[model samples]
Structures are given as structure tokens and as C-alpha cells.
Target: MNDIDDFAQAYVLHRRPFRETSALVALWVENLGLVRAVIKGVAGQSKSAILRNAWLQPFQLIRVQIRGTRDLKTIYKFEPVPTGVVIKGEPLFACTYINELLLFTLNKHEPELHFFSYYQEFLKRITDIFRPDTEIEPALRQKQMIIELRCFEQYLLEAIGYSFDWGSARDENIEVNMAYGFEPGEGFFPQASGLYQGALLIAIAQGQWQTKGALGAARAALRQQLEWVLGRSLHAPSSQGKLMRPENG
Candidate 1:
């Protein structure tokens, strides 16, 4: 690829210590899809002086300029976006999930600005709900996480160009309430018994979170679909499973 000078807004997805005093950063860039670049001598550098402010944190928007290398690029400058300082904790984690998915699945240099915007909006919503001093109501937290995850999943599938039959998959008027299965190409389907509720599928596809119960059911179902498609080699972050696990309390 020719050297291109471009200013891209990106979300830091993952970063690893690079060759002697550098870091290899994976980013989901606006209009550029995913790009992996190396930030030279980022560690031990003052956050006030460099791109350290956005290092390894998810849900942060940054303007990045990079010079392409064979494996990774020389990231010239990464400045935190105007909206960067406000996100933290659970909102951060939710963005991390989005980052992780892009890091593992998206092809580099592909443009996906719309999906990136939706991902950003999802994180923005969660950040707005978070109150550090107050104990998070379990019911509310659960509802929020489920809604956000559903949105993420839908965006992912759509970004990858998968267009499943949402109408048939979520047809509530059907007489048979039987257990259904999802193929990689075909969405939910009634083979023997469509036990999967059509309404839940519709709710998830529509991004509707009207009821906690409906959201919870959609969460469980969508999780299964994403996992199966991602396959065993693509492991979810260890923290992601914890966020989804049921609490005894």
C-alpha cells in the first residue's frame, strides 16, 4: 500500500508492548475499519505529553496519524478526542467488548464508519448511566448490559454483511412454538420444535428494550448466536463472561 496521510478517529481495541520501548496498538478507525500501529516509547511517558491518555482504554475516541510499516505502522500522533475524558468502568468494559470483536474479526483498512458510530453511541449511553459512588441497581445494570450487547451483536453481524431473515425468524403469528436452531447463514429456524421465542428475536433485531425480562431473554439468545459464529478459536475476554454470569445476590 502507498503511504497515505490520513487523519482517522479510532477506538483503541488492544495494545501490546512492541519492539523495545514501543507498543503495538489495534484500533477500530472511523472510515478505515481496523488498523494495527505501533506507538514508539509510550510507556513511562507522561500522559499530559503524549498519547498515553488513551492507551489500552476502550470507548475512547482519538485522532490518530500513522506511517505504515510491513507489520505495524509508526503511529506519529494519537490525541484524545474532545469526548474522551468522560468514560470509565462498566462503560469502558462495554467498549472493550466492541474493541475486542473488531480486533479479532474485522479486516484491516476496511471502512465501517456507521458501525463504529453505533458502537460509540452504545458506549456513550452506558457512560451516561454510570454513577461511580452509587451502587448500581442489579436490575438496571442487567438491563443496560443486555441492551448494549444486543446492539453490538447486531452491528457486528451487519458490518460483516450478514443479512438473515429477521421477519421469518421473528414471526409471532406462527402456530408452532418449537425449538429452533441457527445456522451460520440462516438465522433462527423451526426444524423440530421452535422453542426460541419469535418475539425475543424481533426485540433483539429491533434493538427494543421495553421490558427487563424480554431484554434478558434476548441477551441469552444472542450470546449463543455470536459465540457459535465466532467459534472456539475466537475466545471472548475473560471479563466478558463474568459480566454475563448470573449473580447469586
Candidate 2:
């Protein structure tokens, strides 16, 4: 059966050069999942080429028409969708990180409509917390980024059939002054010298985006789980996942 979408909302996850005038585009379609398509005639300063370059920008929401019988489809049409979700700085890098995550985890042609909405929500929240200038403190901004990332990772893992639970320590509720360790199959358990403390865990469970210690702890736990889930890591996760510009970026 040939999967098709005549008109759909999509976002550009990643784009790289292909041939001369065309490029390979990876789109997260609204009703469909990940779709890799050939976008033709996007080179030079032609009027049409200028439009496609502006519209197909990374993380920009857009409308598209993709059609093909096999795994690789060709983009027949696409246009940008305007929105207030303007992302920059750490949040922008976070967007790339999640884009990489979807590329690694999502299978082509599978319908994950809800996940698409989840992603839109993620961007909105990032936009909400992100300050364009130095209005927010560095520590606070990093903590917020960490919180958003943990939540995003948790949902992604659940969607892929893995659970990285931080709700509690096994059956007992998380206490503010205690330590806890994590097990892959089971959940959290009490450990006097565990990596994360209950104060941090409680803040995490409560969605405390600005709590000290919680940011690093939450990041450490989810990153470990994410690495295990992927069986590896992405391009410089530690640096790419932060506000500081990565060397390559």
C-alpha cells in the first residue's frame, strides 16, 4: 500500500545537500510520521529557490504535500506557517537536539500524530521560558532547558516503549532529604549514596524548572536512559544540549 498525504502540516527536522539543485529533506508530517523526500530546484537565487529556502528552514512549521510509493517520497509542495514560536540560543540548540532525537527514533511512514502535537507544545513552552536578551540569569536558563529536555526525553521514551520513571522511589514517595538509585527494569530505590537526592527528585517530580541540583540530576538520569535506549549517544550531547555554543555549531 502506498501511504500518501495530499496536504499536511510538517516541520523541517534536518536538511542536507543532495545533487546540485535539489536537497534531501526530512519532515515530521502532521498525520504521518517521519518522511524523507527529495526537494528539487532549490539552488541558486531564482525566485522559487528563495522561497523554498526561507520556508524549509529548520524547525519552522509548514504545510506540505508529499507523495510516493516507497520509503523515500518527493516533496511536491510546501509553504511556511507563521507563528509566535521564535526560538533562539539554548532553546534553538534544544530544538536541534530533539530534531536529532526524532530522526534517530521515529520510523518512516508510521503515524504519530499526537507526538507531533507534543512536539509543538514543547516548542511553545521553550519559547515561553526563553528570554531574547539577558533578562534571565544563566543558571536559571540552563535549569529551564534541562527541565524541558527531561520531560521531552521521558515522553519520547514512553512513545518508543521504554519508561524512565521519576515519580517515586519504587513504592515509597520521594522524600526531600533522602538519596535514591535507579535500576533499568525496576524504578527508583533508596540508596544512602545514590546519585540523585530526594530534594532534587521531588523538585523534578513537581516540575520545578528552576531548582538547584534538580537540573543536573534530572539531566543525568534521563541522559543515561536515553543513551541506553539508543544504544549510543548523539553528536556531542553534553555540549549541544547546553546554552553554550558547541564548537561545530
Candidate 3:
């Protein structure tokens, strides 16, 4: 948006130190889909700098006043907003997984407003997973995370115009008992021996998360389709451990 002054809520999708006094930030906002911004004096001991530093972090809801007409903008004001989102350990990698996907897949400077709610829902589920009172087993927690990330991956694909047609396979009515394989532009076609079973695919498509084979099939299909869209291996942000295993595809 080419406004002399613009104010909106934003989350830092990705960022790095830029030069001596500024940070190069990639932001996702409701009004401006994706933006790369420069915010200065973040490291200073001054109160404003500290506020900017705290507010301009991933998963925190920060209100900013920015001004620019181009792809890269400048943030001139930071409105304080208290945040309780703390993502760390294994969960941090999952958080970064979706954040990186957003940075890479979304078009810069366009408003995908619905993504704001989509992202917030994701962060809510993530926060619940790490909440101390939840008392979930490690194995079950991992399964919950797999379902959330795969669903988010599907949202990203839909936003980018690669959404799947759940009801049909290769232009024919999808048979729930059959197996199918995904092709880049050709959609899904039935396979006598396929990596994806129609029932599992339907469960995921309908937002129902199940155990064992269903999760496995969902993960495999998403991995293959997402990697195909990116045209490379979808590497999780560097970790000593592996996250979800979508190896069936």
C-alpha cells in the first residue's frame, strides 16, 4: 500500500540483523499479505528500541505504523502489545516450518486477509500443545502436531492456487476404497498400488485427524505435493532431530 503512513497488526515471519542499527524483517499482516521491512535502532538501550525489539518477533501480535510505496517498507512506529507466545524446543521447529513456508510461498505486498485467522488458529493449537497443564503423552503430542502442520500446508497450497480436488480423482468421482497418486498439473489419478488411499485422503480433506495409517497417508501426500510445488526438498529448519516423517510418499 502506497500510503504515506500505514498502521496494521503484524507478525515477523523471518528476520535478520541488517547493517549496524537496523533489522531486515519479513512481516505477515492482515492488510498487507507479506512485506519486507526495515526497522531501525532495535538494539539500542532506549525504551523505544526495546519495545520495537520485543514487539517485532515471531508469533507476537504487534501493531506497527509503516510508510512506503515499494516492496520494502520502513516501520516508523511500534505500538506496544503484550505477548505470551513462547515457542521452543521441538515445537519451535514446527513453528518455523510454517513461518518459512509463508515467507517462500506467499506473494509480497498482497493482502491475503483470511490467512491472519488461519495463522492465529495455528498458533493457538501450538500454544496448547506446549501448555503445561495439558498433560499429553509425547507420542500423542507429536501426532497432534503432524495434523496441524499438514492442514496448514494445505492452506498454503490453496492460497497459492494448487489446492486439491477432494471429491474427484483424475476427473472422475473419487472412490473411497481406491488408492491414488498426485501429479503436479494433472491432479490425482487412481493407482492400483498408490501411496495415498482415498479414505485417508478424504479424512484429511474433511478436517478429521485419525491415527496410524490415515496420518501417514496424509503426511505422505502433503510432502510429495508441497515439495513438488517448491521444486526442492522441504527441509525443516535445522534441528538435531527429525520432525514429521512423511516417508510413505
TM-score of each: 0.75, 0.82, 0.84
lDDT of each: 0.60, 0.73, 0.72
Sort every candidate by TM-score, greatest first: 3, 2, 1
Choose the strongest candidate by lDDT: 2
Over the full model, what C-alpha lDDT does candidate 3 score relative to the true structure?
Answer: 0.72
Which pairs in model 3 have colliding backbones? none
Native-structure RMSD, model 3: 3.7
Q: Candidate 2, TM-score vs. the true structure? A: 0.82
Best by TM-score: 3
Off by over 4 Å in 1: 45-56, 107-111, 131-139, 169-179, 202-208, 211-213, 233-249
Regions of candidate 3 where Cα sits further than 4 Å from its true position: 4-6, 44-48, 108-111, 135-138, 236-249
Candidate 3 residue lDDT tens string, 104-173: 6654323256878788878888888877777887667877877788788777778667777766786787
- Residue 149, model 3, lDDT: 82
Better of 2 and 3 by TM-score: 3
Stretches of candidate 2 off by over 4 Å are 1-5, 107-112, 131-142, 235-249
Residue pairs in candidate 2 whose N, alpha carbon or C atoms collide under 3 angstroms: none
